[model samples]
Structure formats: C-alpha cells, structure tokens
Target: GDDAKAAQRVVRQWLAKKGITAPHLVMENGSGLSRAERVSAREMAGMLQAAWRSPYSAEFISSMPIAGTDGTMRKRLKTTAMRGEAHIKTGTLNTVRAIAGYSRDINGNTWAVVAILNDKAPFGASSVLDQVLLDLYRQPKLPETASVL
Candidate 1:
C-alpha cells in the first residue's frame, strides 16, 4: 500500500541517518501493521537493546504500557509478581503477535525482552509473552548489557 511504502521510505531515511545498516530488514512499514512487513525476533530484540542504551531510554520506556496500570498492559500480568514491573508495547495482526519491553528484575536491573509469534493458530501468544516477561522479572539479574549505562 502507499502508506506502507511511504512509511518504509521514512524508516529508511531515519536508519540511514542513524547508520543502521540492516540489509535483511525488509518490507517493514515501521508500524508492524503491514502484512508485507517482516522482522525477526532477534532484530526486534536488537532494537529494544539499542533503545535501552540510547539517551532517550527513559523516555521510550516510559511511553510503553505499564503492566496492570495503563495502556495495553493494564490488565495483563495483573496477578503476578510482574505486575507494575514492566513497561511494554504489544502488537497484533492475523499472523503476528508480538511484545517488546523492559522488565525490571528482582535485583532492580532492567532487561529488554522481545517476543513474536508467527503461526496459523497463535492463540496463546500473549500469555506466553507475559510469561517471558515474568520470567525475566524472576531472574537473579538482568543481562550483562544492563550494566553498560
């Protein structure tokens, strides 16, 4: 569609400015709503990691849904220890269900998590993604990169 193509152009220009050279990043509208778009879990994770390292990390993280508090995660993970511990963004499409966020672990370290499911019957992806975040919260510590800043 024209909109997707236009978004792709904008993303390309932004990526060029940022010196991000992802040769394999393809068919994306930067909105994750296009059927033609494709981003691997690893790529999404890398994006989250980069966001965490950026100077705007606090701003970006705060913009996401707060678990059991507001936005898309308002009711999710509500009954778990993960409640109020994560700031995440969710994506949904007929064939794609994804989540990306920073989850604060027990040790007060924030971990970036990105999970996506591409399946004909992706019925339980949200629950699975929530579990992933919860597991991160239960971890003894965030990944080593969390200490970089």
Candidate 2:
C-alpha cells in the first residue's frame, strides 16, 4: 500500500509538472476503477498527442489495442474502414464509457481522438464513440482553397 501511494505521488507530481491541473485529472489510486479518479477528454487527447510526439512514440503506440484486431477492441469497429487504422485504449464503468488514442485517416493523416460519456443511462454509447472514430477515418478531403493550418 505504501509503495502504491508513493507511486501515485510521483505520478501526480509528474502530471503537475506537465501543467495538468486538478480539474483535468484526479487520481484516487493506480486502478482506474476508482469512482474518484477523473480525467477530462481534452486532457486525455492532449496526453495522446504528447505521446505521439515523444521519443518513445513507437513503443507507446504499439502498446495500445488496435481496433478490431486485439485486446479490448478486438470486436469493435470490425466492419468499418477504421478497423485496423486506430490504436486506442478504452475504459468502461456502469455509467461511464471512454476512448482515447490516435487514428489514421484515409488521407494518411493521423488524428488524436477522445470521447467520454458519463450518463445515467449510457447504453449504446460505445457505438456512438465508434462512429466518432469512423468519421475521422473517413473524413473527406478539404478543398484546395481551404487551409487546414
């Protein structure tokens, strides 16, 4: 218990150094199952983006579950165009569902995506989240006159 607490303290310090405020994150314990543990979707997306640009990006990306291929995502997005184009981590609770990670679009651009639903009746929220990824994967090309910058 002492060791776990110490690890949590270290993690909190590191998060603080990264400028993640208390409103964005609250770690009750190492286990994500804690009701008090919280992180906003924006913060999760930011973290994913940071990881994507990190020196250890390859290792970090490889550790995530590939959509419709492995881990918790094995059966998800199986028939979609995004099946194998995403590396994501998923979380679930009785009233909460979330997904956060990088997804590659048909145009070869990578995008960070995060969706979290905290509802009293969050039934069918997974499909909604899946659609969000699919939409990103199938995004239409912007016109030449339109600047993405």
Candidate 3:
C-alpha cells in the first residue's frame, strides 16, 4: 500500500511537470502493467514524441525493441520492409494490447506511432499495430519537383 501510494505520488508529480493532462490517465503503482492503469493512444504518442525530442532521446530509443531484431519484436515484421525501421515498446494484458514507438519512413522522416486495443478478444490487435508500423515504413517517397521562382 505504501509503495503504491509513493508510486502514485511520484507519477503524479512527473505528469504535472511534463504537463500531461490526459483526463483518463491512471498510474496504478506506476508499474504500467496494472489493469487499473489507463492512457489514451494520443497520450501515449505524445509521450513518445516528447521522448524523441528530449536530450536523452538516443538512450531512450536505444532501450526499445527494434522491429525484427531484438526484444519482444525480435520475430515481428521479420519479412517485411518495416523490419529495423521501428523502435517500439509493447504492452499486453488479458484484455489490452498496445504499442508505442517511432518509425522511420522510406523518405527518411521519423514518426511517432501508438496503438492501443481494449477488447474482450484482443488476439488480433498485434497484427493491426504491426500493420500501422509497416504502413509508416512503406510510405511512398515524396516526388522531387523543381523550385518555384
């Protein structure tokens, strides 16, 4: 109980400092794996974007699972063009599945992506999330055009 209280306090302070005002955010014990913990996909994406802009961005991104390379993503997107283009973090629960991370597109632009599924049957959610990343990686390259006067 005490640990949970302490965690809540610390998390609340961090959220306030970060100005994250997600109305539905709940950090139960700050473990991020609790059924009571809640955050919207928009909020998760915002956080990832913030991490990308932070001074420690390199270290933060390095800690994530690279698609088709390591961590939970070692076997994911292995045969697809998305492989090695995304650095993602995945979450799983009986009724919840989520992914949040950055993906570098074919045009060299980086994008933050997040997907969360809360359903009675979340079995196929990962496929949808993987598709999101794949689509990002497969974006068509921008056409080169002459500069206007």
Candidate 4:
C-alpha cells in the first residue's frame, strides 16, 4: 500500500488534498491477508483508477506479478491467452480468495476490476465458498524483463 507515510508520501498526500477519502481502511499490514479486513467493490476500483492516473502508476503497475512468471498468480493461471497477455497479483486462504489488477485491451482502454468473495456471505449452498480472483492485464506484449517475472 502506498500510504502517506511511504517514501513517496507526497504523491499519496496529493490525492488526499483532492478530497479523496480512503475510508474503510482496514489495511494495517498493507497486504490484504488478515481476515479482519474488508473493502467494497467500488472502493477497490477507485484505488485502481487513482493509481492509473497518479504519478506512481508505473511503480504500482511494475510491482504486480506476471502471469506464469512469478508470485502466487503464476501457478494456477497458465492459460494460453493469459500467459503473456495477462499480469496480476493473487492471494488465497481457507477463508479468503482475492485478486486485483488491471487489464488493457487492444483498443488501449485499460479496465481494472477487483472482486472479493467471502464464505460467510451466504452466496450459495456451500458456506465456505472461496473463489480466487486472478486479476490480469492484457497488453500487446510483456516486456523483456517481465518475460521471467
């Protein structure tokens, strides 16, 4: 998480001055691993959109895991179309499955989606439904450095 206390706190504070309220902030560890935290779909997208237009967009994008390359997302999602075209971050646990990232279509329209599923939400017959969200960004090609993650 690029909070105001980060080295690039100036960038984070700039967004705050713009009336952007990052409420519902349960991210004490920065990483979304604790079972005590949750965020709305809308709020997650707002952060993604902000990162895209922010000065730290490149930094944020570069930190993501490359599909079939590195990080947790590399193992499960080895799809042919997603191998190189997609890059993302992944997380999993007995009570949680989450993925969040961006995907740029051929038309150059970058669309970001963050989906979260909780087992206690009563989504279906099974109460322990943990579906992993593998967010991937589709681009023309993966850069040389990212070819290996």
Candidate 3's displacement at residue 26, Å, is: 0.7
Candidate 3 lDDT by residue in tens digits, 1-149: 88888877886677667776677788776678777788898777767766776899999999999999999999999999888988999999899888888888887778888888889999888898898787767774433531111
Question: Per-residue error at 21 for model 4, in Å?
Answer: 4.0
Tens digits of per-residue lDDT for model 2 on 1-149? 88877887898777677665446677777688999888888777666766776799999989999999999999999987888999999999999999988888888788888899999999999999999888877776644642211
Give the alpha carbon lDDT tens digit for every residue of 1-149 in model 4.
65524733563476477555556645445456666656776566677777777788888987997655677656544654445444466556565555567654444455665566555433331212112222223343543632211
User: What's the residue-level lDDT of 65 in candidate 4?
Assistant: 78
Clashing pairs in 3: none
Each model's lDDT comes to 0.79, 0.82, 0.81, 0.54
Off-target runs (Cα >4 Å) in candidate 1 are 1-21, 140-149
Error of 4 at 127 (Å): 18
For candidate 2, give the lDDT. Answer: 0.82
Backbone clashes in model 1: 0
Q: What is candidate 4's TM-score against the reference?
A: 0.61
Which rank order by TM-score, best down to worst? 3, 2, 1, 4
Reference-based TM-score of each model: 0.80, 0.83, 0.85, 0.61
Q: Which predicted model would earn the best TM-score? A: 3
Better of 1 and 2 by lDDT: 2
The number of the candidate with the highest lDDT is 2
